[model samples]
Target: MALFEIDESSGLPVWVQLRNRFVYLIKTGHYQPGDQLPSVRTLAAEAAINYNTVSKVYVNLESDGYVESVRGRGVFVRDIGGKADDVRSIADTEIEGCIRRCLALGMTIDEVTLRMMDVAHRLKDEKS
Candidate 1:
């Protein structure tokens, strides 16, 4: 099984960190279709967190259609269909959250757009 690192001091909750890590693993092909995930107990032990926390992350991922659990077997990664609608929905939600945060910080739309473009360009360059 692959190892995951968790930061105890991060602003994000532990469950969110685990969920995001799992998503990143799936997206990066570190975990493939039918790959068995570590049990909640095992993952919790490894992460030094409560098992319930890991369970919550797995439950959310399963509900989101990213994984499936079999009665007698461990959880497995599902085949992501690359559904554009689902992708767009997730992206829209994330963008909305970012916009809200920027607005709360008193940033104007133009300033936000400029900063977003700058980050986008940097990401594009990094990818290249």
Candidate 2:
């Protein structure tokens, strides 16, 4: 599967979906600091989305301090530093990304909820 996927049917706007996915990847360590992200045009073409949409996402990511775009170079993930205070926000972003993925894969909300509950229970058990 591609690193970036879009769900047109999702209630979330395309830019929002893209933004949340980017944050989730960064926070999860899938995108390490200094790792270069795809150029706006490249990612737009790859995701079959509009250039402006990708551009907006990249701009927002940069503003959020998740990445830095070096002129003539490319967008690279930033060392946002100290994830402690960001734990809640990161968790929310991840949950949203997971639900979006499940919906894109044709899972109903009920199915997603059940799966999530099961996973949560398993995680809680592991912590015991």
CA lDDT of every candidate: 0.84, 0.89
Clashes of each: 0, 0
TM-score of each: 0.62, 0.67
Top-lDDT structure, candidate number: 2
RMSD of each: 6.9, 10.1
* Model 1, residue 58: C-alpha shift (Å): 0.5
Most TM-score-accurate candidate = 2
Off by over 4 Å in 1: 83-128
Query: Candidate 1 lDDT, tens digit per residue, 8-111?
Result: 65899988988988887776677888999999999898878799999999999999998999978999999986642554577789998998899889999899
Model 2 spans with C-alpha error above 4 angstroms: 84-128
